[model samples]
Target chain A: MTSLVLAALLYATPAPQANVFTLETHWRAEDGSDRAFSTLKGRPFVLAFIYTSCPGTCPLTTAKLKRLDAALKAQKTPLPMVVVSLDPEHDTPQAVHHYRERYALEHAEHWSVFVGAEAALRTLTQLLDFKYAQNPESKQIMHDNTVYLISRGGEVLTALSSLDDSSAPLLEQAAQSEGKQR
Target chain B: MVRLAALAIGVLLSSATRAEGVLLPEGRFAPLFGLDKGQRSFAVAAFRLDRRLVTEAAFAAFLRSKPEWSSASVKPALADERYLSQEGGAAYAQAPQTRVSWFAAQAYCEWRGGRLPTTLEWEYAAAADEKVRDASTDAAFVKRILTWYGKPFRREDLLGSGSLANVYGVEQLHGLVWEWTLDFNGTFMTSDNRQDGDRVNALTCGNGATGSARREDYAAFMRYALRSSLSARSTLANLGFRCAYPATEERSP
Candidate 1:
């Protein structure tokens, strides 16, 4: 009977794959719509975390994303990009709009900017192994500057630091993911 | 006599609910890491902390309630292969539940209407001794903690073994399993170097130690290093966690 029970338990176990969409989190998109991360599944996308008001590496990360977007477009394998805010308290819809305009992402249909409460953000960030902490006094966020290429199943296929590493690897994987989707 | 009995029952109910955890007063503490430039100490708010580590039986109860977090169902990305390997039998019911990933710990705390304590808050509460609060600077106390750290770990030791209650009435901070903090991955060494325009190789050259507030506090340093080394999914046999809750607002009579 114990062996039979063990076999049943073994059969019940599901195949393990890391999918960020599996996390239960909600966010407000730049368009003022409440969306669950699962909505982004079934399509390959580039994911990055940044706050609209970050004075340091965030702007660099945005510029890097733009460059990656243009590079992927040239390869005819354009993937949608997701930019989540680390400072959800300050990254209101208006702030995200201004940020999109400032970075010339206003007309980019493939780009999405999202802001959510800290708890939801933490759930996503922890899933991706992204680290961030906000200073209590200065309110400036210290964070890693990695850009990820997520597969259609929401697994991180490749990640590269925006400041130090070239986006060539991420671009290659994103192109491959786009090809698979097609 | 009837009125007195009713009042006594009311007091008993209140104390029973409160016995699950202990309240720690607000204070400032200088942790081993995460201090900004020229920042000395972090101001921690008053909070309630669990009196003991979560036990195997408690975790079993959680797994029963949330089957998705069970070893068979949890995603590999959220917890490693060793997740919940310690079986909860009658013999080990009271033992501290180890081999739990940070995500599982967080979920358990949330289910209990609380959250994992921040690193600063955990360190501040842990600094207290049995008689004196903030005994982190006492050389003898530091030595005793270091001794505990050096002792060879045995899983059997987790049973019926824990530190005496500190000033906050919280026990088992040391000489027990390592606990998870809310932001265990928030170690700012490599990321801070990029912000300061310093080469990443500087961390390898022992420059990370230069930012520590107390170089002699090797126990704290080890804890910080362990926290930095762990991913959200990493689980260790000697690692467990307790929950913390926001302090209730005091009202004047």
Candidate 2:
């Protein structure tokens, strides 16, 4: 505790915020195109993680994202969305594409599905505080099904952990945090 | 040229010694909480682990090399103000570096040419006692480990890097501070964290796919509970970490 008092004296204020989106986290799209999350800078977006073969909550998570997107469009202009696969080993580009199709999100404007190496996914997960686990017995990946809404400046506006939570508040918060050109 | 080659090997050997890590041969051991409740044995590739919990001094040196990781430099996004508090000063450097965020711990391991051990690697290597490889079933050992959990943390108790080495010479897997696992969030015990909509069920009904392998291990259950309660940016007073590296070559018998 003494160190804390000394540290507080040494640091009168907290450090400045860091950019959440950077060119480092690159993803391979269903079309085999690679892009970093930083490429979406100056654009508000939502990020979700799922896998095609997941037997548990992945499908329900996607459906919620769908509703969220629809709600956002109904209120304001549609925002950009990206659904990443937590099971990158099984979630090939083709698998993500089929998964997107399974949700009837085909050609959904500003919404893209991408798959990449676990290394890249790991970096993104770190940035977003996203956590996932694979069960050896079930061969199924378990993860925190949470969606991160990022403002134009790459600031995480809020995180919705429960699927039952309303998207209206998150969209409203995003609306307030968007596009001042950081 | 012979002398020069010998000097190069000397430097390499000395640097490896400075790191003070021990190798655990590749083997299979049941995790405290396996995927199923049966406690079936699973294979874990060999790896190296630090002999002791990382000290505040060791972490401060790392921060000096990478100021972006410094408590003063890391933003609120990556870490909260609690990243390095009063215990962050030079005087306390000899103590175990607690209240470290998981991201910071991961970076420290990487900086040292290692990474945090996966959940299984940690549990497997920790199962060893000084005399036997898997001493987890021993009633005395199990009780001793669980007893550590019951004791409340005191500043006097956590102020050092000293911990008894296990059979494999890995130290403080249980009695010391709670170390970070590479896959801390990988284990499932509480609920389906991935599921989105909760309104329909709201009554604790899961799809029945997820369950712990060793449900009786209350100590492991507490470990998972604590881990699940934390986020990547968390910096708790009693939470610290050590580094682990992948085992590249087999140790000749």
Candidate 3:
């Protein structure tokens, strides 16, 4: 149908290539650069999904990521990070920066914060195997507190639940990748 | 003069639409599956669904166009080793191509000028029996569906894409393969489903019902459970998919 053709064209924007790089999906980083996901490569990165206003799991997820961040620092390993916002409406660039400051992770290695159009968010989340839903009534987003470890080659190494004490393996993998890159 | 011009435009549009599939009109659908709020009704926008389950031949044709999606070319991260493992070449070409990941299904649909239907849209359309809508409560109908549910999918089954037409003229939605919804992972659940006391209560009826929420709907409940268990890269021997698109000029406003 002509409508189907039109829909396909609409979806044929910049990305959704069904690959790990997802490099074509563009976003506005907290620092205000028009960046693509491919630019986030060349270092072992941790991709964590959170929204600033989440009262439940989002905070816990960050705390867990921060712990991992601290451990990586202690081990002299640089963990490049990108904490994506599930609620770009509330967690704007300014809010993400505030979060960075609040966590005292401002000086941490490459923990770039981002807020962008829902389309880029969806593409990234889908590639990361993340599932999230926003509840308008409760004003809370329902999702898993998931953290993904990305290898230097852009493969998603593993997806770990943030509530667990199982950062040991992820830490070791990231450290090894860090050594190879240097 | 305006009326005549509008009619002329409509004539041209109908002719254009006739080039492919038919449109299922807009309606209010209480999905028997998916992120359902208890007794909550949701809108099903007007859309067009491909009349058939994507067949192996169709997929093979798709692969010819998208070399990167070929079984040998796709990396393990994007797809598993079992992708097209049993491809019998032209012999089994018409069989419904199973053992495909969600990404592959999406790409196939995109190539076909549509997309994989959302769980809500799939459920909304499937609730109909031949000649009646919302046959969910119809005992005979539900029993027939359950029969297919209990029946195991034989790998040898061929997808003709012309049988078992529902009221909307959609085919092979059931008694065929478990089709993939575009956002299959959106159905959420707690790992500790057996948790006792307040924890269980909060997880279940917290916002509304989730994971085995509609226990009475044994079939639909199982579907949700299966969907939640699968990751985006999961491929199955019995799972395939169909495509859909928003209806032309769908003025939801």
Candidate 4:
């Protein structure tokens, strides 16, 4: 109860929103090809980080993205999803290809899996204020289970930890915001 | 009267420690051959699993002894290699195997001269303390414990130790891997001739919401539907299992 009260107080304090998304970051393709996000040329993008081997939270996270994709498609929305792998060492182009196939992610024009060197990925995650700590002794990483929503113009729109059907309203709000900016 | 009731509740909440291997009368149920008049007509057997979870070393020996059994496929994402290590070599094996399918777990028990305990038996063991399911205990007690001023002894990083064992020596029946039981398809509400491990989606059905469950776990007829939705090959980072055997002596508590 005390923690909840403290959290509410902290939330009330107005903190300036930081520019967490950088378009210059290089991203990899499901085919093992590398390219800069700037090359995508200002197309609105939704991004999430995941490893295929995770079953607990990762699967649920992927399902959320899938749900979001379906919602956008139903509305004929143009935003695409960019999935970056945290386990870059294992998630090869071929592995990502397999994952895409398994998840029926044939929506290639709307989705892409990116893999890069460990340091590059780590730097980007840190810049975004993503918290992931590897317990060296246990070889396990404890990370905040958050999904980042990024706009094409390199702005972090929102951070979502729980993705349910109720998020459709938030999606609509974001879409409206994007329309106003255009 | 209120004070008396409060004292009774307090005493009920924290008074008993489970005796090792002494099967409490209601501690377990025997598997039945079939049902009669809505009650399982078959004689319930006494199944008291080992006091400790089968260690990695023991499972490793089983795998080595029977090369025919398929081992966990090695992947870069998989951190633990020793699925059943006794000495705790690496944390991967120490954490417990999550992706193992129900069939594969059953195979391990058969190889080890035992069988997996039925779901009823497993729950009985977990409920060894009569108040185990009573959720009315004060959360303030937990908060009070955390505010202590003196040095406290704490066990760290050990999975399923003997301290958590039940009266019949069954450890970690809850909050661990959702064990695959022999009676997989039995209804939780009333006894029926249902398939074991049958999967059904019942989220839309008006059965009251369960205490937080996996979203995908929502299925079947009013929470009585069995889980067959999970892929047999898929393993999760949180899943681990234990095996059980029939007691040598047919002594009823």
Candidate 5:
């Protein structure tokens, strides 16, 4: 399955000797930057995918991300955030920039939004094994709404859904797991 | 398309037959099982599930109408990359979508010119079978049939969707996702002193037809428990639903 390859790319780094990181696969950032997953070399990243036009779950998802962020900040363990635009053609950098600002996600360098071509998006999506579909008539997309937790070295720690309320706990667990290793 | 057109015309012609106007039987409560707290007096439709679940194609059409609400709209729940295809992504749409919160379902139904089914109506319809005369007694057989159909029976022909519709011609009630109804507060096991007027009506009809709910009178008992366990903010993969409307004279355009 494409998910296996994508999972390998996400969980396995560019080099065997390299420290592990997650969600840093070949996917692009909002500025159209495409580098190896190693781009996020030293920061713990919380990744979520979304489109700007959605009014249903996306806003709630962002709110949950913010809640997680706030929870980490309250504990003084704030990490970087990454919001990937699933609707690349429509959700541009400007739109992402606006969304981030609207959601008050502008202060952290560890935070950035990504958009890319359909092929690249598909490749990253396949690597991550995230499920989504574009409708034929309305051209709307249906997808899973889970956020993936990636380590500083680009290794996928785990995924959390709003239903599970696993965002903050998953990140804390990842940090704790990484701390024990160090 | 012709068959669909004929079905549409048939639905138009039989509007009066589906009216939920009958009064409740004695010793029962109103049909609005879950949302009895507020002033929202929801109506119930006495129908059965169509053998086939609603398909991904049918739901995609719904998504198309409400383009603003994509899976991507919510960034952190599940991976939301598939945007407009019918491959692996179709499974989530194909399975009864559970993770859908009550708010989202209501919005979807509103967009489609219908509303979510009432808890009383959903339980009544789901628990009823063709041979089971009493609504109270039909629960066991309905549960058995649903369990049987839901097992590893993988025949594509078993979907029996548009063809083998239920008594009221509504499709895919039982085996789809546990449907969202207008009643969120109604749980399957909660004890309430309130009387359901709709169940009383169903019992009266069963009596008139010489068939009665045989197993037990725990009709309202089961619905209350299920409704209480549901959280308003949760969505799941196995949770999907069909919309309902009062069988009134006003038609959907």
Candidate 6:
């Protein structure tokens, strides 16, 4: 009888709130090191999804990231920027390294590229509300172009949806967050 | 004692059979939307689909194992306030589990060692009727589905409800609850108004579908609209999901 009561109480108890880092997905960085998403906690960061082979939008996205990086660096609040591949099977470590070199992000200290299994990628995408689909026959990927600025606690602070959208607001928020940390 | 033991074994055997689900054969299908320019039909791979919607009893068992998905425990980011509104009690045990967000449904399917069916797979399985596998073109069949869509929500026991099994032995594909698909958000890219610049212009201009494959497929259009309107965490009182698995090799009899 006592055990039954205990079970009933346990059943009603609430669980912890879910955050982006709470998802148990692992990824391989361009440097060939495997790590979980939780390891990136303790600071604000920029996150976006892209495939190295995307003929359209990806180039523009990379340019936007570079601009954002420059803006942040100018402000002296340099935050790490993570670009996760939408097509994980194609974005191997070598492909990611080549991509970095092609874009001249090879020596950028604050930039990281990651690739993971499709299932893990899907889990993270779903959590972040990023939409993407891959056509099997054409090997083309259709995806959203939203870029997220996440808080140190893993909440999405801001999202920029278009390539033309200015990063002024995002820069302001990051600077504020960095100020808070100091 | 012997009779009880026999009953227990029978129960286990039946559940094992049910766990295998129904295998759908690979085929070419023209879905309502998402067709590439000049593409008529796309090939859908063979997969195993759950015969019925996930029941409240089954979801309750899932919650027991993963309490973080419970309505009280779930974060607002993962599920809305209406998540699992009709959750507990034996009254809802046999009914289709509703008020579940797509994330929660996907989690449950993953826990079951399967995944949510893609929008294409769900539409393919739902295209069936009592006799024909692809009754989507039949005017009467389309009208029947539209009628269900037009009706208001009401709680009903799914087990003996008039929703008969389709040709593939899948039940309650329609006339029950709206289901969550694996890639629900991927269907209509143009609907996302936040997009601007050359990408949006390329999609909105002549590149993507100017109109649906068959304009008469109003029911299919409604389904696509509902899917596009929903966020990943959005939950309605009549939304639920079923699992789909990769098909294994068929054994010779």
Report residue B132 deviation for candidate 1 (angstroms).
3.5
The sequence of per-residue lDDT tens digits that candidate 6 reaches over residues A1-182 is 12322322333323234357756779987768897887889889999889999998898899899989999999999999999999987887788888998999878978988898766787788787677877655667878788888899887887887777779889999999999999
What is the CAPRI rating of model 1's predicted complex?
incorrect
* DockQ score of the complex predicted as candidate 4: 0.01
Runs in model 3 lying further than 4 Å from the true structure: A1-34, A66-78, A87-109, A114-128, A133-140, A155-160, A164-182, B1-22, B32-39, B87-95, B160-163, B189-213, B248-253
How do these models rank on TM-score, best leading?
Answer: 6, 1, 2, 3, 4, 5
Query: Can you write out model 6's per-residue Cα lDDT over B1-253, one digit (the tens) per residue?
Result: 9978966764574366356488999998888876677788878999999888888877876897799998889867777666787644787776788888878898898887788999999999999999988888899999999887776555663433635889999888998877899988776444434444423322343333446677667787767766765767777666788988879834222
Best by lDDT: 1
Better of 3 and 6 by DockQ: 6
**What local lDDT does model 3 show for residue B25?**
83
- Candidate 2 stretches with Cα past 4 Å from truth are A1-26, A29-34, A67-76, A100-109, A116-123, A126-129, A158-160, A170-182, B1-14, B17-19, B37-41, B86-95, B150-163, B188-216, B249-253
Instruction: Give a tens-digit lDDT track for model 3, residues A21-123.
Output: 8424677887788877788767778888889888887778889888888888899986877888888788877787778887887786578777876556755
Docking class of 3: incorrect
Off by over 4 Å in 5: A1-28, A31-35, A162-164, B1-253
| TM-score for each candidate, following the candidate numbering | 0.84, 0.76, 0.72, 0.37, 0.37, 0.85
Interface RMSD of 6: 10.4
- Cα lDDT of model 5 by residue, A1-182, tens digit: 12322332243223222122322346567666775556766767778888877775788778887887777677666777777777877787688778878887777566777776544454355445454444322435555677877776565676774434556567676568556556
Name the lDDT value of residue A95 in candidate 2.
76
True contacts kept of 4: 0.00
Error of 2 at A2 (Å): 24
**Sliding window of 10 residues with minimal summed lDDT for model 3 chain A:** A1-10
